[model samples]
Target: MRKLVCVAAMLSLGVTQVTFSADLAGAKDHPLVSRFRGADAVGYGQADFGNARLPSGANGKHTDAAGRLTDIVYRAPPGKRAAEVFENYRQALAGAGFAISWQCGPGTRDDGCGGFRFAGDLADPVIATLKGDSSEMIKLLDATNNNVSYLIATLVKNGQTSTVALMVSQDDERPTGVLLRVIDAAPMAQGQVTVDAAAMAKGLAAEGKITLYGLHFATDSATLTPDSKQTLDEMAKALKAAPALKVYIVGHTDNTGALAHNEKLSQDRAAAVVKALTTTYGIAANRLAAKGLASYSPVAANTSEPGKAKNRRVEMVAQ
Candidate 1:
């Protein structure tokens, strides 16, 4: 339901000349921010629930957030300067009652907004979110020049806040490019986006267990988040479908913290699931068991954040 407030005036897309002709397939403007006229959307990606770590101000600080995330990469019309493009976005956010939390670039009165260091910090994290054929467009941010400008702006309305990050950078040889990442604070729409009971049953029947990534918990916590309701609903339905089946709710964690702490944390999580099924959904407590693997049975390596995420999951195993 969050929409970018409309700018009072359309941004001037200086000297309209084409560099890229087509937008990426299935790519479109995010509802919050309209595209700059004549710009080509070379890269785009969105997730129902995700995190984006964007800078807030100078010196490696960030406006890290998790919510409905969208990444939009654009190549400005030929003859358009990166400074001009950045100004347009700045005004748009300002018109929408947003506050510029951090801005940098020689062209932005911030010759040292940690350009060399910030670029190194943000480039990879930003690029990893891009899923377009022209992902190389992000390389423009690699430069530190008069044409480079970055801004992280935020808006708060009715007790909720959302974040938008804008960066305009042009490599010495490439056209001016813009990366717009927006994180709209929202609870994941439940019942609509999770695996259904039938699929959960199918997976369990085939593999003797089903890994449940949809069931989310805070870092090192046993309490399920609100977005996890739909997955838990499906789990309850699966239990109802087979009344006599014995199941084990097993939890696993990545090797991040102390061994004793992780072991207890994982056990508490598995117990929470069993508690939910037995109390909330009226399943028989005797028919279920709970256990914690505590990094001992990792499905993936624990070397990367993505891998650690994969290892921290709940599995429903058949007895």
Candidate 2:
């Protein structure tokens, strides 16, 4: 009888050890974020504070001010479809005071908007890291790789605007995946410290170089924002006041991503600034040379958000 009982106990242990569910071990939702009902977190990461570029509309992006950035990946409960998962989160976000900025899904009215294409790019790293050796799971993710449904939303709470990007996809394996990214936009930086034409002239005369912090550009793009007009105008005025003052318009960036990419991006931005000064502000094009030094001469350490912000600026050096 004792031998029979021992065999039964061993059988019970084998039954209890059966594995199920694909959620990543020890994954959990962030404090400032939440997962959809019946969904389990499969991956997560966060930066204490950073900037996030949120999709504004079709083919458009906007940079949120410095704040905490959080990313979470979730697996939907069995029997749920990707579209349904997206809708559930959309409704939940709306209920939580988030205004939908944009939304798209497979076969939906906005199906061809390229939102899903962007989502696939955003999900690549997360899935690669968390899916591991599960070839079936990888294939499942790739099946809907181009059919992802997504939503971008914003909410203002506690005097801060928070941006959210949510994406969902599913495959024949019956498991849906959702990726959530949130950026808590901090208050806009204080008014830009402007160097007037007089200050620029003095600096050029004495130090042969002047740094300007007022110029602004869209995140990861050469396009100047509207608020950059005043700064460009000042620069043009200084150049016009001294017709013989040839200078180099140097662009600098923070060491955030790939060095090569940053070098190219900075060069493009400097060239754009030169074009704006000449064409829009009526400064002579021959008087300015555009150069990108990348992150070689950072004014501060790149270990913190404020330092990174300071490193991304345009400067003028006498030539």
Pull out the clashing pairs in model 2: none
Query: Runs in model 2 with CA error above 4 Å?
Result: 1-26, 60-65, 107-112, 125-141, 187-308, 311-319
lDDT of 1 by residue, 1-319 (tens): 1222354332232323223348887677765576677788878788987867777765556655767788888877777777677777787788867888778774422344653343546555666667775346656565545466788887776666668888778767677888888887764443345788999899889999988888888766899888888888999999999888889999999999997898999999999999988888999999899999899999877764456767888999999
Give stretches of model 1 more than 4 Å off: 1-21, 107-112, 115-118, 144-146, 158-160, 189-319
- lDDT tens readout by residue for model 2, 1-319: 0010121222111233212254565455544446556666666566666655554556544434457777767767778777666776776677667788777655221333543344344556545545333453344444444556777887776676777887776765658877778777653372357788899999989998998888888889989888887788788889989998899999999999999999998899899999998888878889989999899999988875677878998999999
Which pairs of residues collide in model 1? 4-32
Q: What is residue 101's positional error in candidate 1, in angstroms?
A: 1.7
Candidates' TM-scores?
Answer: 0.56, 0.48
Model 2 residue 66 CA deviation (Å) reads: 3.9
